[model samples]
Target: MAKSQTKTKTTKPPVAEKAADAATTAIRLKQDLRMIPLDQLDFSPLNVRKVAASAADDAELLASIRENGIKQNLVVHALSGGKFAVDAGGRRLKALKQLASDGVIPHDYPVSCLVEDEQNATVTSATENLQRSAMHPADQFEAFAQMIAEGRKEDDIALKFGVSVDLVRRRLKLARIAPELIEQFRVGELTLECVMAFTLTDDHDRQMTVWNAVKDSYHIHPQSIKRQLTETAHSASSSIGRFVGIEAYEAAGGILLRDLFDDNAAAHMENPELLERLAVEKLQNAAKVFEVDWKWVEVHLSVDYGAFRSFGRVYPQDIEPDADLLAEENALMAREEELAAANDGADWTDAEADEYYSIEPRLREIEALQKARQPYAAADQAIAGCVVTIGHDGALRVEKGLVRPEDIPVAAEQTEYPADGDTEIAVTRPNVSPPTSSAPVPISDPATTLRKADGISASLADDLRASRQHILRAHLAADYDVAFDAMLYALCEQALSRSYGTEALNISISPFLAQNRETLHPDTVAQKMLDALEQDLAVEWMTLEKPDDFLAMSALPLPQKQSLFAWAVGLAIKPQLLSDNHPTPIIEEIGARLDVDVAACWR
Candidate 1:
């Protein structure tokens, strides 16, 4: 058996011998190099690059060929009528043709080509295109930066490269990223988007700081990078920035950092303090319109509902309409009725529906005009003030007829008047205690305040107060009946006498503003449930004026009213811990009644 095996091995050939022989033959094939006329060289149908070159690519190739005369020879094969067909370098052929057409090169210009046999033309073309690799994006970025450093103007570079000015600028911006980050991007440790985000600022130190902070985190996304980079800056889309428009901000010498790569991305303002100052100044200027009629005008960059909790609001009253306005209203109502009757049980044309719908808007306009004519009471305006602030939508929000606590009139205890000629009639008012359900009991002793205890520090006292506030809020959130009654009493007292004041609840009929909702409770089950309930409620009442708001609230079902009241009361519940680190008896009593499990609520 061993002798037979040795005998067979003597005649065996190596593996892949056929492939090696074919490769050796291919390498030994003769390639014909010749200088052919540009017009004589035609593109081959067998070329592997079938996609048409873009105008920019063509222009770039033409400029390069015109400047350096073809550095690489194109592969070609002999064709009919003494012409050569280019099997590869289709882009170069196109550029040569363009140069000839533009008279930069003659039609008979000598173009160097490597002539191949027809049988190997397609293979050669495929090998030429498939084997060549495109330049890496990092290399291109650095090349552009090098060109800029060599005293090349950006515009000139763009023109020479056949690219857009914006694109050139973007490359330049990307090149400005920190070298360490660029290396990371080159090595695939960082994404191009992350590097682009770093281009938002030119400060390498800042970029490195952001990169180092995010390098160890799983959330090193482009958006997160941009967010960190512009942490102290304000977005141009923010309410304050919008209030102070980009044009105005720029005119005031504020720098705006824009993402050149993303046209839709929001620009950031480098000077947030300047933006705030501009917003406040504009608000102050806007307040001038209200200052003419109001007793005092206060300008705030944004609305802080907490500051206005103690301020009483005066609603607009309806006035009698003039004869002309009444006639217009009657006509509009008649038209609306006629249109409705015509469209009953049938689809009306769009034009007819539009005409019918226009009647209501006119009626609303008339109603608004009438309401505008109704003046605020002179007595109320004397003691009340107006606030000019930025709304959530970045529009000027003017809240008028806000009476301050100090400006409210107090009731006298007794009254003495002359009733019959020289007879003085003394009428003494009865002393009545405020209702305990709505009125908060005054804390007079220092022991009842939220001050430091025997062993606890001030910070601990604050933390304990905050904890108690959260517990009270949780209890109030569940007890809808108590919340409804409390809100009702507060609203009624403010509306009727306008002299009621309490520390129990800070009930302000304004939208809750939480710049960071997760800062307090990060996605707790209770928060989610409240959010779901709010989403289910009908909130059209928020958009209506005073009388309309009243009508809308009255129209709501009992359940919706209770839900709204609960949500409002939950938000209105503040920390009742006084300075002495002592819990308010009212909050403690409410918590006791509800049987609030502190551990469960915290959980």
Candidate 2:
């Protein structure tokens, strides 16, 4: 046996020494330095360039000069006796002159002077001011980028300026920032923190993404971008629209209404009769948003005729579709009596032995040789018809925000599933749990427990399918809450699927049948809930010690097993409330004021 050696070399560039030397050199430097005489300092007269050799703000420059005082001595060329022209510090000279004019500084003051040899004044001043502090690291490197540009290593320039090569390396970084983003930062309303580094790449398409986000919303933080990355996430408009609907929408500070009947100004028109008719028209238009009956929208409209019109517009959800459609849609569905009449044995796939199969294969082969009994699969055409009916119902529930997210998957499944023949499945929905008194009650008796857990009983299959539906939908969400229906639905689905041929696989869902499994025993309730909570909820740990309603919830026959489904709704809504573009109340309180009565709202 042989072992291979993996060796990698680590490169270390000594940057700390250079930085320390620069700072030390800066402090020890000696020159005739003093605050310039305020009246004499003509900052505006000086031919200084823009900040950082680019468009810049006066804030940092003003702050530094105000805090530290002028540390750099101005080098000037001797023009005559007792007089000199500034060779450098033209910008500093101009600012000092401005400060003096504003009476912000003393009228006369001492100044640091670098009276250089006249012949080489420009050369000397340029060389001195081009040092590290006068220009930023990026700007400094840019000013002398020639050496690094012309085959010389960046380390050489770094050593020359007594700065780290990495500090100089970012010169490349600054240049690479998307020009669009740089302009945005310059505009003052936009921030650089929102823009990702990837968006700054030379790729113009990627650069446009950053540009588009900023353009759409003046302040697009990173989270906003991430949310856009997944279109499944709620939008500012869509979520509120669906949950509140038009009635709630108008109640909130959203949809504005201006209609004929409500307008007193309409009566003030010069032609009273015409105005009255026009007012009716406006009211009709206003009422349309609420889908009010024709009479409600138009006072002249009759209730009976309007009702007939409404019926024509509205379609029944539970209507069965064509028999052929069901057969086309669902393969498993078959008539119980007919299927029983046709069957002698179930179709079997014989197993062949190989290294992959082993002894287990032998068992499967023996089992295949034995008599096969048929297990019931639901009537396919009927189930498909139910699905079509349920789809609209689910949409209505979602539009009203009446159904919690946890209930969506299960509800969706329940809408589409049909009753079984021999299996005798029922859709059991939980009753709402009432608020508890100070003390908690014990659930010692089975009958008493079932009573308290009061739930509406429908077909078992529907309930099981609802749970499966929830699980499927839960998979769509990235967030995991502890009270999601998805997990409960998944658990029910698992039991139902395995029960077809394997009696051993059938599970007793009685524990969760009445009570909201998500609330009563969340771990056994919904996996989606756990995943959502793990993704979104901040664990306080203290809430864990509080009394749980599981015992009482379990006692009810079909106590709303989805009570905690409301809790998952809260989790989902919490993020919406806390988001940056949250409504005025949310913006003012920063999501602190979000405790609303869901039960009362629904009622």
Which candidate wins on lDDT?
1
lDDT of 1 by residue, 276-338 (tens): 889878987888887777789977665533345456565554577777988999998987887
Residues forming the 10-long window of minimal summed lDDT in candidate 2: 385-394
lDDT, each prediction: 0.70, 0.38
How far residue 167's Cα lies from its native spot in candidate 2, in Å, is: 23
- Tell me the spans in candidate 2 whose CA falls farther than 4 Å from its real position: 1-56, 133-232, 237-603
Residue 44 of model 2, lDDT score: 24
Off by over 4 Å in 1: 1-31, 50-71, 95-110, 305-309, 319-374, 406-603
In terms of lDDT, the poorest run of 10 residues in model 1 is 436-445
